[model samples]
Target: MANENTDEGLKRVVGVSGLALSIVNGVIGSGIFVLPAIVGIAMGAFGVFGYIACSIILAAIMLCYAEIGSRVTTSGGSYAYVEAAFGNFFGFVINWLFTFGWGILGSAAVMNILADSLAILFPGFANPLIRGFLFFVLIGFMVLINILGTKQGIGLVKLITVIKLLPLLAIIIFGFSQVKTGNLHWEHAPSLKTFGDTALILFYAFAGFETSLGVSGEFKNPKRTVPLGICVGGIVVLIVYMLLQIVTQGVLGAEMATFKDAPLAAVAEKIVGPVGATILLITAAVSCFGSVSADVMATPRTLFAAANDGLFPKFLSKVHPKFATPYLAVLTYGTLIFIVSISGGFKQLAILASAAILLVYLAVILATIKLRMKKQDAGEKTFRIPGGLVFPFIGIAAIIWLLTSLSKWEILSTIIFIAIVCIIYLIMKKFQNKKPVETTLETIL
Candidate 1:
């Protein structure tokens, strides 16, 4: 089939390395740096175990997504997968909420970190207005970098990923040596009552693994690569998170680490002194920056796909003549992030964004089952998930359990976001009633 859009041939050449980098970039963001403190506060010495439990659950969820990605290679991630298995309208609503709602908020959280770090480095620059302006400027810089196209954007992700991991690795190595295991009180087990909150917080840390699925169209061999990347990348992050938590607990103990906002930095100072702490601070900033870059690269593809299908403003689908990239969509998402950054603080947006993505995750798990049954007659299987059908079934069940664990406010906010997206989707459907149907599995693959 001939490519429909003139610029549709602008392929993203992200191989296994780029895919792994994107996953790490997605997982490591602001959450790892700050979330340990919250987890410690809630779960105490047992927070490390909570992290491990969340990692296992996330790995199961990733298995479901890997099945979907193997079956349908597309740019919109869960939206495209669910749409392919379900229907266009349902997919549109899900995609709309995923991209417009959560994507914008996630980007804003990263920008918030950049702004906060800048304020810390130069105390006089802490004015709200100045911080807001600088936040937008930082978003613009990332937008421009992505506008240069996928390879360029991935290159930037690689650089920042390396820079971000250095201090984290240093902390784990040096901080472990300073551990006084007596601080881990065996009696201080995390109560089962707080498991729900721990799961919610852990969700934030693992929320971005789906990002690798977003660029499925760009992978050299998505079936093999996406699953491998998701599994390997997830394990890598799980180890990193675990090590960081262990070092934090061992070095600072549950009490001090739980209280400090910059727990890892505090540990670094104790182990390797002030200079080490400074390096960790810089790493946190770079980690946020790298996540922003990866988000810039991947999320706009959803807008581009939506626009191509007549679900969004058509112009957003237009690729840049020079860069062969979705310039308009990138700017559109960036603008939303800028507004959110100025209007609200990072912590609120981060939690809300995590909630939104969790909703999309539920859809992805169901989509996996639907596609498996729908495509069974097709007799085409490049990669089947281990444990036959049992794994995917358990995965879907786990997601449902997690969904109910969300706080009442998070659930209410998610509903409102979904309703708003449905309203917009209906409006677009009415306007494009006479237009040719544009979304198809073949075109997307």
Candidate 2:
């Protein structure tokens, strides 16, 4: 057993800049690379409205997170906040929901995008065997970087984030000149259903910001960092997404639907020729890699936190003496992602991943309301949202509205998945001793 009184081996090294960049890396991922075409197909020149709608929804959710995260100040992000407000059962449920239901599945889907983008650049990647090998190498590489230390993991995220954005910024800057004014006009507004469905899919682009909050335990000063980082990072993401949508839609216009898989690359090819297409493809690969690396760096902390609270296997909580990281948790997470990615079943479940994340966000919003009513941090100087409960309610309504777009099967499957997670939690509790074992720092080294 580890010593509980000692501090966890994790170092508080990440600051606001790192956290903000992490949020950017998480939110602007593979979805943006392809979503332009999907939204453009659905809404034409008005497709940019989808980005605006999603930003509003995400803004509400991020406000709730900023408030609750300031008070909770722990790892596991949504899992930790909900557990503190509700109980261990709900916490356990959320941990699995966010970790496996959303994080792993979503990253696996993005891994497919990465592989496909790479295959465009290198034809050999088109082979199933080669793609599987690529998944193993990429996932293993991320695990190793994270296990070595959080700094290295974050450093790579920062580098790739910058690398991926350059090509995107270039398109936004140069492509607008080539956009025909005729392509920027729409005769009529899209119907509510059409708008809702497209916005629901675009929401996937903004879904992973919470994953960055999973490393609160390692944040240098979380109270200030959480709110500032989330809000600032969120604003940056909104701007980038909106501009990209405008440029992509403006450049490709109705023809965006022709290149469903790589809309941004098509836009690039139009603006700067074939060389531009090559750069955008490489950017897509790097952007996906950055998102997965950020996940590998942060999401494992949710597993580590859960295990320490006796909701997961104890081994996952063990901190490496030399590296001061949850090595086992990182390895486990990477392995799951690799399995799901190589098997290529995640695409079928992609909508389920979106639905699952909505549930997680709904839970967190409710947790914020509960925490506020209970005066959980009355004495502590924690960040509070400007509107008492208005934002939380907005977040709730937006999530519910978005969830309405799910098919009956996806909704039922989400319910089944939640029930299965709850059952597993109960079984673990039944076998646990009167006092659950808590893992802490084994040694400081």
| Poorly placed runs, candidate 1 (over 4 Å) | 1-7, 254-259, 345-354, 376-381, 434-445
lDDT of 2: 0.86
Alpha carbon lDDT of residue 282, candidate 1? 75
lDDT of 1 by residue, 1-445 (tens): 1112233645747777788878998889987877767776777668888887787778778888878887887677888888887888888877866775677777776777776776677775578878877877778988888888777888888898888888888888877788888765557566676877777678667888776566666666676778877877888888898888777877777566444688887888887778766777778778888887888888888877777776778888888887777889888877777888788754564555656676688788878877777635455656667787777666667677777877788788777877877787787777676354454544676
TM-score for all predictions?
0.90, 0.93
With a 3 Å backbone cut-off (N, CA, C), the pairs that clash in candidate 2 are: none
lDDT of 2 at 413: 81
Residue 411 in model 2: lDDT: 91
- Give candidate 2's TM-score: 0.93
TM-score of 1: 0.90
